[model samples]
Target: MEKTLYVASLFFLCFWTKAQENKPYNYFVQESKIVDSGNTIEVNKKGDTVFVAHYKRQDLINTSNQDFIKTYKGTPFFKNGWYRGKVQTGTGMEWEFVMAYNIQKEEIYLSNNPNMEATVMKPVSFTMEGHTFRQYKNQYYEVIYEGGSQIWKEYGCSLIFSNSSQRTGYEAEGGDEYDGEFLKTVKYYLKEGDRLREIPSKNRLFKLFGSKSNDVKNYAKTEGLNLSKEINLVSLFRYYDSL
Candidate 1:
């Protein structure tokens, strides 16, 4: 009877330990605060789980490789967004990447250093106008999009000039002449179908609708869409396509 009771107690203890280890984690909270310990997960505006920080707190013990685990073990790994995979340094030391975001700026910054400065780390790739773009060494490149068109296929320009005359004293007296400087703006374009077109332009609807300009205008009016406002062409195209 004594031996049976001891065995039962030992089995119960082992079962409880295994249950604790297998329990789901709920350590992350969706708040806009800096985590000093680097032990939190953050989600971005696109509803993608992005930021992850894992500070190894377990005792190293007599393990040969401190970070030689076959798989990641810690907070649940997010499968949708970009993550810091295990990397082996030249000196054989393994490290995990840490990431942070500037919520106000809508930018994700990455660094190997857990306590890295926000200004020093590079911003992660993001979607703009329904396309993913990446910035490297001050140059921007389109990473992914629905259409197989390059972001910078062609360029357009706008020029403006103004002039005015002011009377210093009376109409009979001398008048001062003023001329505004000419302002020019360069715009980017992409090829849609057979024509190269500027994005987010009022003329885009004309291209998409062809002879149905009136119908396009009516649709835009019904949807309260201001063609002059800054808009995402891809999103606008999708909306029109649905109709």
Candidate 2:
């Protein structure tokens, strides 16, 4: 009886451990706070926490310490004690940058777009069922399959060029200057596949979906999901594969 009870208890423990392993880690909700001098704590939506300290930035000056050689225009602020800096790559460049210093890990995460306001670095990849998935913001995800085939599905806003015209602008005096105006539109990508194909119109969904259109719509309705929403394409495809 004693041995049987021990065996049953071990089995239950293993089951609980497996359940914890299957829980998804939330990469969203990048929040951080400073605890003390040079110390900061960061937490994600999944409740996983990390403590960082000793954050520092490279001074934008030459060894001579004379005049400013490299200029960084934007001022950095601390969130939960972690310093976020928008470091410009010199002047006359078309790009802005942001970076974070993890003093404990001695690591740095660079922002691809300076125009974005968020400064916290998000986890780029997560594993599910031994398959690795990479996320690019909330727009799309790239799934690396077991056979090494990379499948990408992206849904987001894209600019559409409309029309162009020239308009005259009058300066202080009699000088007149002409400027070109270009119109644009916002559109969303529909459907998921290995390639990003632009949907010219809602009518094109018929061609894109072909005979599977009705089936896909039915499945979406049954699941109470709207395809037009920011759906998780990876999870959607996984459910489709199960069918």
Query: What is the C-alpha local distance difference test score of each model?
Result: 0.38, 0.34
Per-candidate clashes come to 0, 3
For model 2 the TM-score comes to 0.25
- lDDT by residue (1-243, candidate 1, tens digit) is 698667655743554465346433222332223222343444545554433433222335864322111111122222223344332223333333453323222344334444433222233353323434444334333432244343331211111213223212234543222112112233445545544455546655456455655666676677777655435444444455555
Q: Would you estimate the TM-scores of all the predictions?
A: 0.28, 0.25
Misplaced by over 4 Å in model 1 are 1-109, 114-196, 203-205, 228-235
Q: After superposition, how far is residue 35 of candidate 1 from its true place, in Å?
A: 31
- Cα RMSD of all models vs. native, in order, equals 22.4, 18.8
Highest TM-score: which candidate?
1
lDDT of 2 by residue, 1-243 (tens): 698667655743554465346433211111212121232344545553433322223335743321111111111111222233433222212222344432222222444444432223333443222323344443323343212112343322211212222111222443221111112223434324444455444334435445666775566667876444434333344454555
Candidate 2 global lDDT: 0.34
Tell me the lDDT of model 1 at 83. Answer: 46
Give, for candidate 1, the lowest lDDT window spanning 10 residues: 66-75
lDDT of 1 at 69: 10
